[model samples]
Target: MRTFFNIAAFAAGSQALITRGDSCCFHLTASGGASGSVGQLSDGQNRIGDNSLSPAEFCINSGAITDGNGRGCILTPPTTQLQCDEGATPTGGFSIDSSGKLEFQGSSKFIACETGQNGGLNIYTTESSALSNCKPIELMADSCAAPKPQPTSTSTSTAVATSASTASATATAPATPPANNGCPTTLTSGNFEFPHLIVPIDSSSPDTAAGTQFNGKVTSTVSSIFNFDIPQSDSGKTCSLVFLFPKQADLQTSSFTFSGDGKIDFAALSGIATKSTTFHNAPSVSKDLGTIAVSPGNQYVVSTFSCPAGQTVSYEMKNAGSTSLEFFEDFNPSP
Candidate 1:
């Protein structure tokens, strides 16, 4: 029942892409070389502009369906034209039902956008989302495949009153700086939160030191590591490095993490759910710096952002569900 996905008008006056308004579009099956839908530049080589119009916004990924820029439409190897690829893990990730019915990891295949092989309009899912020339693209045209919201700091929303648990206490104090209290740039919710000790990143990447903090988890993956500091009076004010999942469905990627040692389920299955972190490094594994997307009407999220205050903020963090990530720094506020 959600359908206005114009996706920022497919942008074409200057360039650069991503303008954003919670947009969505992905309709493609045209033949004149383009035009049924597609717009966040899906890497198949870019060509979407018969006047563009709209369409190209899908983001449900725990394995892949990505296209609001996270890419992944991949299911290739059969005809070879389907490849939007950014972090492609596809084989699963598309499911949609409450009676809306969309399937891909639910497996009868079905994504089909059509035209392929270089003739243009490419994208497919095979076994039929009704291919022939391809054109089955419907999820109400598009409005909910999410994934994009990780910056928090306009006073952190300023109204959380309660609900917390990393030893709970929910401390609050820092938020007076958009020129010393005129505030409202957005981040305020930091009734203060604490609980430390995290060391698991034995170098699959991020920086090269994991000799202590007691030396645990890094058995080969599920990365972790910690270090925090940022008080010069919070210098210019935007501080967020949060994580606390006791259940907003434990923020998802679910196999029941936190206790269920199933390897990497730190809540790992909602659109492939997130747990990627990397700050202060310099190379190409990418999370850019930190990635946080855990929502069940909000489960105290926000996993990265710092300001000019002082310094020392290292987090190597990895992915999967529940391995312990309760942090608060000039942070808090999300009941």
Candidate 2:
């Protein structure tokens, strides 16, 4: 059976607080606080507020346990809260303030959190269904003291798609200036997948190199597998470079990188061919670039994004450049 929580309204402008506890879930709402102030509680460990409200000022050893997650104090109309156990899987908790601003809370020690429902609790940003902007926050526990020895399987699926082929195509086209191509301000799904690669950087000259470097060491590997899952769709993908570095000579400390929102030229990752190469300024190390390779688009799932082990999935890069390049790979899905 589902459990319903009780909440009490204190002063018309008083605040509320939520803390850490072990419960399946809780739903709460509260009102009152500074003019634009908002407050909420979830579980028994957390006490939070937003621009609309501030943290409770007065004192309390265990705070209110009224409307929200088991034992949280409230100070706003938009207050909501939730809490649960870390049994094998993780779960999420939630809160809504008096201004209708919904918030999410997750436990770091027991379970990790997600952005939407399915694991447990739900929250709405508005009263009307059409205007409701409710999202779920899923949390999972990877470790628990409870022992439930489950079977361990060896069959592995692709965490992400991984490919193993020597690409012969090269980046023969020259670098062009940025143009308006309807590229969305945000990179959601349906956009070109962010390309990953390793580039060789020269450190001797700091001003000119594409990235920074130190001592005998230079560039750093900026790689990740991500999920390109936006409902809206668009054209091809393009990438630029951005770099970060430290002051002294420490190979382990200082590093080089590609430019702003850069994409590691697959041709570079493949160590094959180049269309245009330039060096601007320097006071650091510089040298030949590195090799590039391609793995299964799904490999991005494993290497970049997160997914359950042994799950079958595929990924593709939308509007990719015509150039082909070499690629390395590995795909072991969890079971």
Candidate 3:
């Protein structure tokens, strides 16, 4: 089966793609345009995989489809390959279709997928993989249902937020505590500037475990579960979760690659607990916030929720690309 770009039909933030029989999902080459023909992301797709990061943006606009980084997709002139450009002007606009014909721009030429010698799939705009002798591989990447998560018998949980700010030593204590309620209004994450820096934690490893050492680094890139000793403004007022990532300069000095495109990942609040380890390996309910990207230009990113009064809440982020989230006293008003 074949698919085409249907620009007019695409809704804002419409989701797309996951090739069947493959567990490997797509990632935007950290430096777009430099890695490939242009920066290639989920051309129009983001497949959620096992221990994967949250889905990157695969937004659709009337003019073109942008990558997770919000860079506009463009065609490389003289060559049919399409990619996201970095400050590079687009050669032309892209038209999409779902007629399953694999055609581009309604011409004799068709969209094609060619497997390179390096075993990479390259998208091109020349001839139909089927209609032409040029014969490219037809990668009919259809929509596949996301598989359900199985139980983690020896469950592990922790989260450190990613932000580009210097964290303060004092934590923001919870507001309007009901006499003995001990909800702190501020939370922060550990330092794992790069994925390699992430240290895994489990019950057996108290030094690394957030449950055992509640004051240890409160975040981990290695696991999806994050238990936060929150900054609960329990006055029935909203509470904020702050995330800090190393700045570009720090990342350069440390010789670490930027892990995420600065988009705040979605986290559903799972079980609340007196101790995070006690909540581990226990089944519980969860809350869902719809899809949206975090704007990190504010030095730090903040996510506010209905404060869970006196309890420490665990946000179950389902991706590894998600930075260790922290909590801040307040959101910066200036960019």
Candidate 4:
């Protein structure tokens, strides 16, 4: 029934004072204010539900309650005092009642969720969702659960689509061999400028040369040349050679063994070659550096290259195409 607000009551006007054995529960809501307060009540056994109590049993606070107007009419003794002081903030707290429902603070911040309290939380909506954004104040809880990882099986594959030119020599056709226009034809040994021309190993055989030959097939934009020739300089000076992959891709190879038959018959493969040049006339006096080689007719090998923007260069490599082989060498001049 109607519970009059008692200054000495448990939930203020929300519940009646326990007279030895008597007990009651109540729920509260702040319908009009920007923010509200709440409280909980319980005989520690039963719980209370919102508005379940008959209107007559409830009392309104004078300072906090109003008839929607300025000072219209403040209810009786208990109700008048139950009205919250003007601008008083609300902190909703709930407690269990004799039944099992929670009794909560009559003011607004719906923070409590026990019996006899306002269970008006829309868990998934803005108001309730706002709870997460609130600064977290710690209250020793049992434990925090570990976070779950995102599944990758269903994630999009990020394999980059690299170009073929990034691998083997793009073509066997010579691009007007590096300009020898200003190159001295008969300069003294050891005196030279760069953009140095590669000496082609001249031979009628397609695969036999003085040095080792690469045998794998290069699956790239470039093609292999039948003429294995790099014009030699004056000769007799030890030198080194380097090959670059103009772009980033892969060059697969089976092995690095070179056959003396003058061919490199590599297995399955992918190859990348950008700048591949042999150096001549260095100080290899009485020295012999074996040739670099790859194997497996079709095995792709890892390669790297970064070409400047605007200008393009072929980055490719060649392997024993089905059964192809290339030859190389380290030789001294004919004394």
- Best-fitting candidate, scored by TM-score: 3
Tens-place lDDT digits, model 1, residues 1-335: 00000101111111111111122344432233234444434354322333343455565422235566666565455443445676664333343332333433232233334344443344454444344655434322243322222222432322222222221111122322212111111123323323233344434554554443322232334454443334455443433333333343333222222332212222211111112323233222323222232322222222112343454334443543334332222222333
Q: Model 1, stretches more than 4 Å misplaced?
A: 1-34, 38-88, 91-118, 121-141, 145-189, 203-222, 225-316, 319-335
TM-score versus the correct structure, for each prediction: 0.26, 0.18, 0.28, 0.16
**Where is the poorest 10-residue window by lDDT in model 2?**
1-10
Q: What is the lDDT of residue 129 in candidate 4?
A: 35
TM-score of 2: 0.18
Q: Could you arrange the candidates by lDDT from highest to lowest?
A: 1, 3, 2, 4
Please provide, for model 3 over 1-335, each residue's C-alpha lDDT reduced to its tens digit, 9 standing for 90 to 100: 00000001112222221111112223322111112221233443221111223434333332134465666555553344656655543221222223222122222142434343232344555544342323333222122222222222322212222222222111222212111111121232222221111122343444343442211122333323444443333334333333333333433222223333222333444554323343245324364321222223222212333445545555433222344443221222111
In terms of lDDT, the best-performing candidate is 1
Judging by TM-score, tell me the better candidate of 2 and 3. 3
lDDT of model number 2? 0.20
Ten-residue stretch with the least lDDT total in model 1:
1-10
Answer with 3 or 4, whichever has the higher TM-score.
3
Native-referenced Cα lDDT, model 4 = 0.19
How well does candidate 3 match the true structure, expressed as C-alpha RMSD? Answer: 19.0
Predicted candidate 4 versus true structure: per-residue lDDT over 10-74, tens digit per residue: 11112211111111223333322111222222211111223333211222121111122222211
RMSD of each: 17.6, 22.8, 19.0, 37.6
User: Over 4 Å off in model 3, which ranges?
Assistant: 1-221, 224-226, 230-233, 248-265, 273-285, 289-302, 318-335
Which sections of candidate 4 miss by over 4 Å?
A: 1-292, 297-302, 307-310, 315-335
